[model samples]
Structures are given as structure tokens and as C-alpha cells.
Target chain A: MLSSSKVKLIQSLNKKKYRQKYNLFVVEGIKNIKEFVFSNFLISNIYTTEPIPFMQEHQYQIISHEELKKISFLKTPHNALALVELPDTLPYSIQGIQIALDSIQDPGNLGTIIRLADWYGIEQIFCSETSVDVYNPKVVQATMGSLARVQVNYTDLKKLLTTSPIPVCTTDMDGENIYTSCLPQEAFLVMGNEGNGISEDIKSISNLKLTIPRFGKKQKTESLNVAISTGIILSEFFSQKEKI
Target chain B: MLSSSKVKLIQSLNKKKYRQKYNLFVVEGIKNIKEFVFSNFLISNIYTTEPIPFMQEHQYQIISHEELKKISFLKTPHNALALVELPDTLPYSIQGIQIALDSIQDPGNLGTIIRLADWYGIEQIFCSETSVDVYNPKVVQATMGSLARVQVNYTDLKKLLTTSPIPVCTTDMDGENIYTSCLPQEAFLVMGNEGNGISEDIKSISNLKLTIPRFGKKQKTESLNVAISTGIILSEFFSQKEKI
Candidate 1:
């Protein structure tokens, strides 16, 4: 049984402003909710059609399916939805191979990149202020529990690139081929917007520029998708590091 | 300038059943339409809100913005939309490094893979019968003009695998590390469904099983997105091929 006020609070998290105001975001589906239960993220509320273990009686609301639907954003609502408290935006302590985003607007792209970063053992991601909000519900759902593992910091990407102590690399059409280049073990890798490559301000300060060579015969493709490029580059970087 | 009958015909192309019945598909956006105009695809009718050069007056209908919105599937309609004649499905011919998809259900994934095939110079893609139709409007939109270059064929993927004349490679969790493997230049790379990867029948016939190494500590991530894995594996294959 869900109270009207509780339902309204869950629904409100869909908007960026509300999420910021409350410092809360929604994570849906049983699998995602289960992953969150074991992670370090603090769970404020759990609403489900069925009782789930590890959820205290007061913390969880065993609501009817209709009530669950009222709060779910999915077309077909998953069995459970959880409200998770957003972690504080801690200062980035750059370690190895940190990712910098230059105004990536798509929630799905940002989410997938975070998951990729988690897979490659990257600890931190620095997003330009214009990038999609990390707490967006769609992004949270897309991350598939990776949001708990990776730390994201929203900041001025241009300034970070200029002040970076290590080598900074960004992709370009005429840049050195990534396949042949010797990428550093520790560096800042910048990926850009879907429509535009890296911003001019950040691109100008980068110490290295790289390109993923096009193998197609006609080679008519404008460029690889930003997220796909990141995967390939990261794979190549680790493959090289492992070889040495 | 579009008649009621013509508008109805254009709008009907959105549905797969209707598209098959009429042998036509919708291609939106000025860049996409221009690519089709230059490619082998025959444009049956083009409806635009503004006059477009290089289009014969009789072949194009100058319609109001409201009329375009009525027929367009996109939330924000582009300047023009074109009805393209579906080319006949030609029999598959063996080629260098083909991609086979088994039950790939997402339109965006199918489309992105097609574009990725175009980028890596893979000329042909074979799809399981249950895979999403390549002509889906969402797919055509996501391809971003690469659909014009890559040839996609829907066929019995199992039969193709059994009869494959070259090495067949598929990704699995416990397979050999892709970095150290000697990937053949001519092969069929099979990527599986988003949730349930490579069907059992297809897996049995594969000659090579490769895995993309996960570098994350604890490695809680189950797997990379299918399309991202495709990019990584394809990059590795071509890079090795180029090395020799």
C-alpha cells in the first residue's frame, strides 16, 4: 500500500530539477534493484508488487501492481522500483586512464560509457557541464548497477585538459592512427558530442590526437559513434599495456 | 502539392506489413535521402516542405509542414522524407569477415551494427530470421546513411554457419582471450541477442570462441553491449590482419 505522497515523490524523481532538489533518483526492475541492495548506495525507499528479502518492513511498501504502475516510467513496469540517494560529488583524484566527456547530450550514451568505464577498471569520469545529468533515470537504468561502482564528476572539461599533469588524448580524423600509436599507461582520454567532435577549447590543449582508422573500402562513414570509439580505444590501450 | 492518396501511400510505409505489401520503406532527413538518391535504391516518391534541388518536379511533392508531421514517424520531422523501393534480397555470397546476428531484436542495435559493418569495411551481414527488420524506420534513422553501403540479408543463420567455408568466431564468457588469438582475415563473426547471447544451435557450429577481457577488479559487469563488443573484436581482427 503506497501513500499518495510517496507515489508523488517517486514520480517527481523523473525530472532533473526534482532529483537535484531531493538528491534522489529512481532505479527500476528486479535485477537492478537487487544489485543496488548489495551496493554501497543508500536506499531511501523500495516499492514492489511482491515482498523482497533484505528490505525492511518500514523501508519497503508492498504496493499493488496498479500503484507500482503509477510510479514506474517503463512502458511495462518492472516488478520493483527503488529510490536511491545520490552520492556527494567528490573531487576527482585522477589516477589512470580517466575519461573526459565534451557535452555528450544523450542519456543512453553517457550511461553506456559509465558501464564501459567500469568494465575497463576506470575509476573516474569527468563530464563537461553540458553533458547529460548522471542522475537521470534513463541513464541510471542504462548503467545497470555500474553507477554504484564508477565515480562521476561534472566539471569544466576545457580547464581540466589544460591543467592535466599527464598526457591528454582526443580523437580526430587526421590524427595519428590509434592502431599504431603507443598510448600512455596513464592519461586523460576525451570523447565528444554526437553531432560534434571534441570542443575547440579542449581539443586545442590536448597533447595527443588519435584516430580510429576506417577499414571500409569506400570509407564514406563520417566517424564512429562516440561510445563505440571509446570502447575500441580503451581495448587497444589495455591490449598495448598488457603486451609491454 | 501531395494528393490525399499519395500522402496515405507515404504514411502506410511505416508499418512492416504494409512496407512488405508495397515493397517500400521510409528514409527521412536530407542527408539520408540524398544518400539514397545517389545510391542504387530507387526513390519512388519524395515529399518535402521546401523545394529541394536535384529532384525532378514530378517525383517530389511539395507539402505543408503539417502534412509532413502527419506522415513522419520522427518527433521532429526533418525537411524531407522519401519513400525508397526495397531492393530484392539477393542470395548471400561469401566474402571477407562477414557478421552474423542471431535473434538481434533491437532496431537501434541492428542499425548501429550495420553502420559499424560499414565503418570496418565488412561488406555483408547475415541476420537470423527472427532478427529485427533492417527497413524498420528507427533502424533506417539510426544507420545515418551507412545503410546505403552495407548489404544486409535475412536468412537461416544456422544453415549459413553449418555451410561456412571459413572460420566462424563467436564471443562467449569463457572463450579464449581475443587479444592473443590469431584471427583469420576471412571469417564469419556471430554476435548474439542482447539478453541471451548466441543461440545454442549456432554456438555448436562455431570454430572459434573468443572473449573480450574485462579488466575491472571483481568484474561485476556481466558483459559489454553487443554492438560495443562487435567494434572491439572487429578492430582487433583488422589490426591483426593489417599487421601481417
Candidate 2:
């Protein structure tokens, strides 16, 4: 049985302010919640209609389907929803091939990018303060389960790029062709906003500018989606690293 | 003034049955409508609140914002919406590095794939009949303007693969590493469904199977999103072609 106050608190997790205020976020679906259970993130509460086999060892509250629907963010609510405590913000470090996002507004794009980073073994992502919150319900859902592994930090991107020890690469329309260019094995790959490319402050500081050359005859495809571009660029970077 | 019957008719276009019955689809926003206007598709009607500079020569019905909202599919209605007649289906031909989708149910994924194909100069896409309709409003919106350039066809994927004169390639988990493999200059690349990848029938018929190797240590990410995988594979194919 869910108390009205408890339901209110869970539903409020949908907003950034509430998430920050409570230091908690929502993770729905048994599979998604399973990832967080083994992760560093602590589970604050688990509201479930059925017993999750893997989660039998953990404490969980049995609730009705109707009760589960009340707090679930998805249109078709999953069987279970868990309240997860937000992980502590780890200090950003420049390691081998990192991703920096500049004002990526779309939650789906950010989530997809995080999943891509996880797939490519890029551990950390540095997002501009203006980028979408990593903990957004939509972003979390889009990540599938990669949110458990990928460490995403929101900070001043310009400052981070300026003080970087390695080369800073930005994807551009007229830059040297990505295929032909000599890509650095270790650098900060900065992806810009959906509507605009990289910010001027961030772009001017980046010495390496690479472009995924357009092959279409019309040359009318404005640009690839930010998430797609990230996948393509990351694949290229990893492929080049493997060869060396 | 938009008629009540006309509004109902426009709203019905949201469903596949209605779209098929009328042989028409709705395209919203001035930029998107402009693309269809210049394409092979014919325009049946244009409902707009503001005068469009490029559409000056074409006929359009002026309507108030309230009227536009009533007829618009989007939450925030675009300045205009146009009803574009479905183009005649051309016979599917095996072209250089073409894309084939097997039961891609998500409209956004289909649309993004179409746009990615346009970016890589792959002109045609053959989708399994079970795949989402290309004329779906969500798909049309996601394709940006690329829908105007790329041709998408719905057909029996198994039959198409079986009859293909060119090499048939499919993305699979246990396949040759894409980075190391000598990719063909011209092949039919088949992308599978979001959940269940390449159907057994399609998989058995494909002679060449390629995989984007996973680099994450945990290797927990089950698979990349179908659309993101398409972008990476397309980018790799083009890169190899350029080198050759």
C-alpha cells in the first residue's frame, strides 16, 4: 500500500528540482532496476507487483498493479519501479578518449550518447551545464542500462576544454575529412547542440576540427542527429586506436 | 475556415488505414512541407496561418492559429501543414550499399535511418512489410527534410535477400569484426528489428555478416539502438569505399 505522501514524493522525482532536493531519482522496469542494484547507486525503495527473481535477496515492497501505475513514468508502466539514490559527483578527469557535450538539449540524444559511450568503453562524459539532466526519466529510459556504468558529469565545458592536456576535437562541416585526418588516440571529442554546432567559445579553443564528409549528392541533409554523429565518431576513434 | 469534416479527415490521416485509403499523408512545418513540395510527391492541400515565401506560387488555405491547432498533429503546431499525395512505388533495384530494414517498428528509428541513408548517399531503403510505415507522421517529422530525397520501399525482406544478385550482408552478434573485415563496395546491408534482430529467415539468406565490436569492459550493453547501429555501419562502409 502506497501512502499519498509517498506517492507524491515518487511522482515528484520526475522533475530535476525534486530529484536534487531528495537526492533520489526513479528507475523503472525490472531489467533497468537490476542494473542499478549491482551498481554503486543505492536503492532507496522498490515498489513491485511481482517478485523479481534476481532481486529476491534485496528488500522490496509488494504492491498492486494499480498502485504501480500511479507512480510509473512510462505510458505503459513496467511491473516495478525503484527509487535510487543519486550517486556522488565524481571529479572529472581527462583520460583516454572522452566525450564532451555542449548544450545537448534532447534527453533521448543524451541517453543514447551515454549508451554509445558505454558500448565504446568510454567511461566518462562531460556535459555543459546547459545540457539535459542525465537523471531525466526519458534519458534514463533511453540509456537502457548503460547509465549504471557511464559516469556523466555536468560542468563548465569551456573551462574543461581550455585546461585539457590533450587535443580538443570538434565535428564541423568544413573541417578536414575524418577518414583522412590523423586522429589523436586520446583527446576530448566535443559534440555540440542539435540546432547549432559547437559554441564559439568552445570551438575557438579546439585545435583539431574533423568533419564526417557528406556523400549525398544533394548535400541537403542539414546534419546527422547528435546521437548518431556521436556513434559514428566514437566508432572511428576506437577503430583507429585498434589499428595502432 | 477549415470545415469540421475536413478537420476530421486530416486527423484520420494519423492512422495507417486512413492514410492508405486517402493515399495521402500529413507533413507539418514550413521546412518539411517545402521538401515534399519540391519532391516527386504531389501536394493535395496546404493549411497555413502565415504566408510562406517559397510557397507563394502554390495554393494554400489561410487559417487561424486555433484552426491550425485543431488540424495539427504536433503539440505546438507549426506555421503550416501540407497534405502530400503518396508517390508511385518504383520497383526496388539493388544499388550500391543499399539499406534493408527487417521489422523496424519504431517510426523514429525508420526516419533516422532514412536520413542517415541520405547522408551516406545510399538512395534506397527496402523495409520488411512488418516495419513501420514511412508515411507515419512521427517518421516524416524525424526525417527532417531527408524524406524528400531518400526512397523507402516496403517488401518481403526474405524474398528480397534471396533474390539479390549482389552480396547480402547483415549485422549480427557473432560475425566478422567490421573494423577488420574487407567490406564490399556494393552490398545490401540489412538492419534488424529494435528488439529481435535479423529474423532467422533473413539471417540464413545473408552470406556476409558483420558486427560492430563492443569495447566496454563489462560488455553489459545488450546491443546498440537499431538507428545508431545503422549510422555507424553506414559511416564505416562509406569510409572504406572512399579509401578504395
Give the winner by TM-score: 2
| Cα TM-score of candidate 1 | 0.96
Tell me how candidate 1 scores on lDDT: 0.87
Interface RMSD of each: 1.1, 0.9
Tens-digit lDDT track for model 1 on B32-127?
898788888899888898888877777788888988998898999999999999987766678788899999999888888988999988777999
Model 2: residue A28 alpha-carbon error in angstroms: 0.6
State the C-alpha RMSD over the true interface residues for candidate 2, after superposing those residues.
Answer: 0.9
For model 2, residues A1-244, the per-residue Cα lDDT tens digits are 8999999999999999999999999999999999998888899999999998886645999999999999999999999999999999887668799999999999999999999999998888999999999999999999998999999998999988899998999988888888877789898999999998799999999989999988889866868999999999888887777767
Clashing pairs in 2: none
Model 2 score (lDDT): 0.90
Please state the CAPRI-style docking class of candidate 2. high
Model 1 chain A worst lDDT window (10 residues): A216-225
The models' CA-based lDDT, in order, is 0.87, 0.90
Q: What lDDT does candidate 1 reach at residue A105?
A: 90
Q: What is the lDDT of residue B38 in candidate 2?
A: 82
Q: Candidate 1: where are CA atoms >4 Å away?
A: A54-58
Model 2 chain A is weakest, by summed lDDT over 10 consecutive residues, at: A235-244
